[model samples]
Target: MTDKATAAGELTDIGNKRYFGEGLLRWYRKERRDLPWRRSRNPYHIWVSEIMLQQTRVDTVIPYFNRFVGRFPTLRHLAEAPEDDVLKHWEGLGYYSRARNLQAAAREVVEHYGGEVPRGKAEVSGLKGVGPYTTGAILSIAYDQPEPAVDGNVMRVLSRYFCLEDDIARPATRVAMESLAQSLIPEGQAADFNQALMELGAMVCTPKSPSCPVCPVGEHCEGRLQGRERELPVKTKAKKARPVFRLAALIEGTGAYAGKVLVRQRPETGLLAQMWELPHIEAPDEEIWNRLDEGAGLLEAALAEDGVRVKASNEVVGEAQHIFTHLVWKIKVLGAAALEERYVADRTGYRWIGPEEFENYAWPNVFRKLLTEYFLLVRRG
Candidate 1:
């Protein structure tokens, strides 16, 4: 373990630590946003909010959070709910794995900890999807354990205050920041101090054009003094998302399946797992994409591989785009009608869902948008 003297070497002179810590906490008490999660110190609520808040903005998460908690209400409630229903609530939130892990962890908590969120570091860290940052946030915020929660916000604030130029995207830099953050927490003030750091970063020490003048510890901020606030928390650029073209089959149902559309469940594992979507086939390249008839043939062939036969029409119904972290999908919707009224015996994964039944199954935002547009088009006709 590195000594505090070495870990916080250059940052040692940034005013008295007590002044910065206390002043920030005082400011937080007066200015902290009254978010739904802050209303209680329940570990479960904090855990849920923290998970949802990852890679998502505060304002955007508010309604989702309210709805999620309203539906689940408690850890047990979440654990008991169907995974599909849970995904339904989290449909548009993205980073869907977070929801899955949250439910898995909730079940773990119920079975292993008597339905209570564990307070100890080791126990909490063992929970699925609970990383160091989340572990610290729950322990400090809910249990008042004086642990450090070093997320991007805390790292940015600390980097600017201490003028540390380490790349926050690196693992070593995060470890160092965690240490520095842990040292700054005053005894028994972990909740307020941690929250204050995050609040300052969000509202004042933002990524761009930080409000340096209004910062409580502005005078002591080394990055501000050096005029390098914007450059301190350096992060490497992420790789560009690769584009993928796909042909989505808007299969129209007939006979017993009339007034319904054909949808299939994604495999139980991997990207967008367990969500329902329109049957789609990846177009080989720009050549395949340029020819709708050829693309329709490929879509039909792909569906046959899955044991469902259909004849795709050349007409394009609509188009949509969805971007994941590493991939971008440019989709072209094509009309199709089932060649046979009944699918093969093992067609359980595929279903004919009516417009009104759309609410029962969780569709990724891209598919949901496509289906909505298709339904509106039908209604107009």
Candidate 2:
């Protein structure tokens, strides 16, 4: 390989690094998107915005960020609120675990750090769910610490700029990218430089069809010069999501609980843990699932196993689909009625909530859609 080709893999050239950093930051000051999170320097606000922005787009996160910060306002407010309330605000955003972890970390901050976000790297990283990217982002952006946040955006920009052909999905690539990114942060310009790199990737050097003609640092980008901008940041594809067939019961209330519906709390661990949902069971095959009567029977039997009994109707109320990172749930909602009112006495993991009480429980998006449809049906009748 020629010397220039070999040099593309390393950031040993100091002049190039200075030029790239300075050019990107200059463009950022003139063109940075007017985001709500960028308006504040409070570590708490920045921390919340960074967590929400993970796996979510800028436009989608804007309203959620506004409402969340408006509601919580401070670490103490989030720590004091019920987990259900916090999850409700975070509903429809997906990745519900982030919301739960944020609250857990908030409570820790309040109790341990006197309600102030810790500035030290060790203390910040120790907070639950605050990983390397978040640690660097919070430290550098909020506290002006010269920490490098090497998330996918930063990695992509760096990988393409230096023509580094490392698989970003690998841990080793991230460690090396963090070192290279840290080196590019000009003295006392870590905040602007890091944000500028991320913004450049997000706005200019996008994953597909990057607009290189207008990129501020296009003059020195090795990937662009070598015609490999689209392929430099190679990533291993993720495994396919496993499908799960579920029979959900929209069990109607009877007797004293009339005008309400039966909902159950998920186990305290695993996916959607502690969230409320209509009773559901894992169906074995489509043969049984296609048979509405059998599906209702299976749902009733499953609820009975949990010490609750209901007479499910053969009519199917609705169906919904939800996708998680590793699991895809194809849910069929079946209508049902309370068989006997006596089962209400043992309401350990279950409860009959009136329509108005729905807001009190945090229903996962799938259940939320199903329940919304069911309520609309009731109102139409």
Candidate 3:
């Protein structure tokens, strides 16, 4: 609740709180979708599912979650697996940093906690990539501890139900919401209650337009009663992603390296770290990027500056776009042929791989799609 609400004596009535909890639980038990992660009480499975579910949809994560657990069935397996193999399993799932942090945390657990997730809140929160929300989720859902797993969905639901007009994007507001959420958890029903709140938010109390009439606790929803359900839970908008233009070379190999294409691994740190992709260079402006002949020359010059020589042709091969939280890359690909055999002695990061070796390296989604299409066209030819 905001200070204004508190000062106005607009606290959640005791009756409304009781009804909200009981109504949510009853509705969840009866109408909840049967999810794979809910089938068992395994802490590892629950932790992985929570991590994967962050900023990702439930339906998209189902198959990935199943395959991930099947590949690394236990904490030790995940801790011991090679980074590349772990990355391979998580290839299509964006936000590669999540997978990296998860593996790092798994290794820490294996060594310090003896391959078991710690029950203490501090211990779980200390793991890499496990923030307050994830900590609460693992503690409550996995251990059945009375913790509040408050996320955007939970906040939206609570703000509407309680008619809170606070800006949810603020750190202080989240802390208050977390405190309120923890207080509402029913005794001995932390797991189900927390999940129920999340389910209600996801299904009924949505962001755009809430289905208030069908909501179990709609009878007492302050936002709905006040006719401000959509206006509550105020949030600030994020900055737009900045656009960048890049030129990529689809360099075909010749001589002994025939049937292969040139590729390079990204630096060990920073964006798309350690991922492989077609050789490319950022264009100074969009105009040059759109001009294939000029962009091809700039691409060759840029790669030569880095000791990677290729003869880029004016013909366009492909074009694609990849969006990140802060940046967007508008890429134009040009046909090319490798011009130097010196790369053979340079094992730095460059490689000439044929379609048979596609499975050997993980690629960013944009490049993966481009390469997949290129291979399919070649096969047809």
In the order shown, the candidates' Cα RMSDs to the true structure are 3.1, 2.8, 3.0
lDDT of each: 0.90, 0.88, 0.90
Worst 10 residues of 2 by lDDT: 337-346
Candidate 3 runs further than 4 Å off: 1-12, 341-346
Error of 3 at 19 (Å): 0.4
Better of 1 and 2 by TM-score: 1
Which residue ranges in model 1 land beyond 4 Å of their true spot? 1-14, 344-346
Residue 65 lDDT, candidate 1, scale 0-100 = 94
Q: How far is candidate 2 from the true structure (C-alpha RMSD, Å)?
A: 2.8
Report model 3's TM-score to 2 decimal places: 0.94
What tens digits encode model 3's per-residue C-alpha lDDT throughout 171-220?
99999999999989989999999999999999999999999989999998
Q: Model 3 Cα displacement at 364 (Å)?
A: 1.1
Worst 10 residues of 1 by lDDT: 7-16
TM-score of each: 0.94, 0.92, 0.94
| TM-score between candidate 2 and the true structure | 0.92
Ranking by TM-score: 3, 1, 2
